[model samples]
Target: MNGEVLVGILGGVGPAAGLVLHQEILRNTLNDGTDQGHLDVVHISRSSDMAARPAYLAQLEAGETTADDDHNAIENPAYGMARSLSMLVLAAEARSARLIVGVPCNTFHASPIWDTFAALVAAEHADHVTLLHMLDEAVAMIGRLAPHATTIGVMSTTGSRRARIFHDRLEPAGYTVVQVPDHVQDALNDSIYNTEWGIKSTSPSIHPRAVQNFQSYAKLLAHMGAQVAILGCTEIPLALTGSEIYGMLLVDPMVALARAMVRSAAPAKLVPLDIKLPRDVHLGKPKRTLSVRSDSVDLTDACETLR
Candidate 1:
């Protein structure tokens, strides 16, 4: 255990979402069918430690928080994330020499929030933890899963979409990005944030309405000729747990992030992409076709294919 590299998760963007990421790490890992064979992982999820990601982004965009207002820790979700990351870093370092961490929240990855959190990590926890970019990993997964796919659809929170998180990344990479119109986005948001049935509110047991809304919105993206759809929000995968929607391949960035963390910590322990996915791991089928061999493909190869 002392010689092992630990996988760290900066969780609590939403508690259930964080647990799903932790589960994905375990699911994607190549274990010896025993608890001991699994990689060491440190998952810290103090939901209260962080402000709501969407609310924070909304505030930033509304000019509720200014560029120079570094003193407002309560309004800035980044400070909370950095603090959680520090705890994660400290915990991971006490157990291993190296730590690879991934934050599961897509909205948190928006520039205003991510840049601030990243700076804090670089200043304090940089030497202790290597944070993986969830969006980049997901984009690369699309490349690996569909090398010829040129149009990518994204389903995320209003904050993430408003922040142009996926747009800023995918458009520059030469892929056409598809998103729902405002009304559709509102329905999409309801599926994840609605108090009565939102995935965030009732995860581990999805409401049928939430699933319908997600599939409905995804079909809209398919109508726009999207060959692939990214479940950009961390809570989204729970609501849409299928490999494809309307012939569009559904790719979860969290899965990519988990696989990447395992690769970085211990490539040999990383499971082959083609391995039978657990019931909830959702990639349509384990035997689906691939441009790269399931046995040979790794995160680096996937990202390179995109380039």
Candidate 2:
């Protein structure tokens, strides 16, 4: 597996998240005085039909619909996720990449699909593909950046709202997960998934209503004495430019994951390790077998040098 580390992005869970991740990677590695890109990346932007899942689930949960009522919506996500993950594996094998990362923070798909995807990759590739889970990164950042923060609010899509992985991971870390009210959640979901971020649209247009909804969510979190608020959905940071709205720290998981991914890609050194089985792997988890080092080059400096 001696080759350039190509990063395969399983994107289009929401287009904005994929774009943001690409932008962050470009920002981090545009200049290294290398003719080739600092990191080789392969991205698949297939639109995962997450919008239909919530509506179908809502009906099923309400007993208004049977399990067989919306099998297409129910089954589509797993297929999409598996397809995306499979594509990552193929790309990794083609590039002989050492790292493979996915940016979808939706707990619904992530919980069920991750292990299956890992197994598929492991069975086929074995010890070559590494999965980077983003939720763990969010939990770790909250602990490090705002350790004493008691109440934390999340602004994300309906999928993330239903999954609650962020909440599950954060609660044990001593933070109260304040969910936006149903109406507020609907507004946020509609603003993102129902619009351009949805299956039909392509252009990255910012929804003013969504931005206002997030702003209102931020205010509500601040009112609830939340020391920090997380933009749980990937599209959120694209909507809300810059942090600190109404004096609350808006933590963008995509940006956090981006920073973490950069660290993961730039290792101190590569070492040979016998990875035999599937295990829970989180980004930034130290591997005693490998010594990794990264030279912190300023983005501005990198850009200038590249130009």
Winning model by TM-score: 1
Error of 2 at 203 (Å): 5.8
TM-score of 1: 0.85
**Predicted structure with the largest lDDT when compared to the true one:** 1
Worst ten-residue run, lDDT, model 1? 288-297
Worst 10 residues of 2 by lDDT: 281-290
TM-score of each: 0.85, 0.71
Estimate the lDDT of model 1.
0.75
Clashes of each: 1, 6
List residue ranges in candidate 1 displaced over 4 A.
1-3, 67-74, 275-307
